[model samples]
Target: MGVLPLVHALVPNSVGNLGSLLETVLPWAGLAVPFALLAALRRRSASAAVAAGVAAVLWLGAFWPVVAAGAAADEPNLTVVTHNVGAENADPAGTARTLLAAGPDLVALEEITDDALPAYRKALDKALPHSVRIGTVALWSRHPLTDTRRVVLDPGWSRSLRAEVRTPGGTVAVYVVHLPSVRVGLFGFGTAARDRNIQELDRVLAQERQDKVLLLGDLNGSAADRSLAPLVRRLKPVQDAVGGGFGLSWPAAFPLTRLDHVLGRGVVAVESWTLGGTGSDHLPVAARVRV
Candidate 1:
């Protein structure tokens, strides 16, 4: 029983890659696996087996990372904000105003439509002088952007993109992604498409040579999900840096689970938090990092 906490904490951070449905179930399953192994090894009593199973399940699903805070940093800072403004978002002006007020050095937006683009452009034009938009995902920055290119996450879907921003501190490769959403059914979690998207993203992240990388998106799954392992393995989640909790982001009104995130690699997080309502289904997430 004492070793359970240690086992739970040491498990590689693969759980976040599992997507949404599997996100909830796999950890619980992971917890039970150890107990089942113990039962087989010791031929333990039924009650002992049940108790071990429960402990493992709890440790995997609710503890560990939940208690781990983001890494500390000491250097120049860059503030970034990410939000998935719903496709049919009505208050583009208000959302833009709110985000601009945050004074982020970089901003990534997803689910942008032609109709709302103009309003957003007008609203952010003064603060964010440089910008790039591909399909529905876009990046706006206070600094110049170089080596900008549309990252082909899926030949079938033309929405994600990657760009290198030239900040005073250094060049940071930023990827703005809107992964496919997953669905739940009687049998179990269904995430074939989301998994494929993650694989494509994995290839992109693997090939990156830049020292600093920032991934901002509506991942549709929390760090606890396993399907996002490809990205999670390489990048550190911002929420885990500056402690406050999960920073739940979906269903802005009463967020219970974190769906949007700001992940970084070769960069240190200074602070991270959820932005207030954006008139969309998701609440925006922002992070300050030292590059």
Candidate 2:
């Protein structure tokens, strides 16, 4: 139990997001750790009780974001949806329709390939008249998009893009990003490239001059994940600020980690939540924010 809190903090999250994964599942320990603490107390194990108490403190501290309350989503300035329409999704059209039916002011997508691009464009063209596709990342908006360009966070590929949305309230800079994926194995977490990609994106965000910015997509990391501190510090995760709970949205069937997120800078998240899967590995994350 004593080692539990230490483990949580010292986790080398950079290795393969091992630390992040640990944090993602840390809440479960809240239940198990106390039970163990009670058993230890009953057994009159002073050391065990102390250790359990430490673990409980650390666990709750790490979990505060999930339970914290914030502004409501009512009367939102903007309603956005971000999804990772899996590259192999069987029904891209269906996913597109489902996303559109949500009536989002903007839709940000990751994992869009050349072949799948046309399908999405065709499906969204009528409803979202303004759209931009730069490599694998795309943004379709009900508002006009201008000054769009690829962000180039990774080498040899495009996984991020930027555009300015002319909304009813004002123009907000929108970043559609698909950060490099991390992996795990005997080799531990493989976040080298992913880390590098994050560094580059971090630099770009640091220089961002926009007053209101919306970051949307499959970041491949959670808001609480240590590896994402740089971005998290600059932006407010909609889910963490207003979500009722974990709001997990990955591995759709048994959604666990929140790999997809909608974060904001200079905006207030009124509401946030994850929707049921739309033939993708990740469930769509939606948020309403006050600009």
Candidate 3:
């Protein structure tokens, strides 16, 4: 039982959503290890000692940064936020208004369809003067936007885009994305599409030469999810550096996970937080960064 948590962490998950789901509750599972060991020791079990040692290594190995705080930065150069506005968002207008109210230097929205684009544009026109979209994702900026184009991530459609925003500090490359969603059941957390998308996105990011780059939108996975390691290896999540608890942003009513994120490369995080619930299922995430 004690080695179970460590086994899950080290071994690749083959079952549906097994590994990913385990990540969501791994902390709690680890928390149980010590108590379980205590009970075993009280029973004078020698195996308890060995299990205790294994649990310690597993907990530390997987969550050391979380307990210690990650590489968050200070004194930001700009602020940005991201959200995956559910397609059926009951109140798109209200969600748009709520997001603009945060006054981030930039905002990225995902899961936006052609039909709802107008409402978002109208609601944000006055606040976000410059905006662009590719497929279902879009970016609004306060600075000059240039070199905007579609990033052909998947076949027959574009779920991502890139734009160069000339901020007061310097030129920053911004990529707005809504990676493919994962499915459960017999398919077993089908992530082939999302993984392929990440590979392409990582390639673009790797080739990018900008001093600072920001990836804002719904990644459909958490920073700890192994499938996202390709991007995580290249970019550091701002909230990781600037801690505020788990900062989960999905399912606004009772967020249990952080599918939305503000990731940065080269820049530094000043602070990060989740906004109050909007009409969308996702709670908006904001971050301040120094480019």
TM-score of each: 0.80, 0.88, 0.85
C-alpha lDDT of residue 259 in model 1: 82
What are the runs in model 3 whose C-alpha is more than 4 Å off?
Answer: 1-8, 14-17, 28-64, 67-73
Relative to the unseen true structure, what is the Cα RMSD of model 1?
Answer: 6.4
lDDT string for model 3 (215-267, tens) is 99898888877778889999998777766466888778988778898888888
TM-score of 1: 0.80
Q: Against the hidden true structure, what lDDT does model 2 obtain?
A: 0.83
Q: After superposition, how far is residue 40 of candidate 2 from its true place, in Å?
A: 5.8
Best by TM-score: 2
RMSD to the hidden true structure, all candidates: 6.4, 2.9, 3.2
Clashes of 3: 5
- Per-residue CA lDDT of candidate 1, range 191-228, in tens? 77877898989998999999999999988877766667
Candidate that scores best on lDDT: 2
- Whole-model lDDT values for every prediction: 0.80, 0.83, 0.81
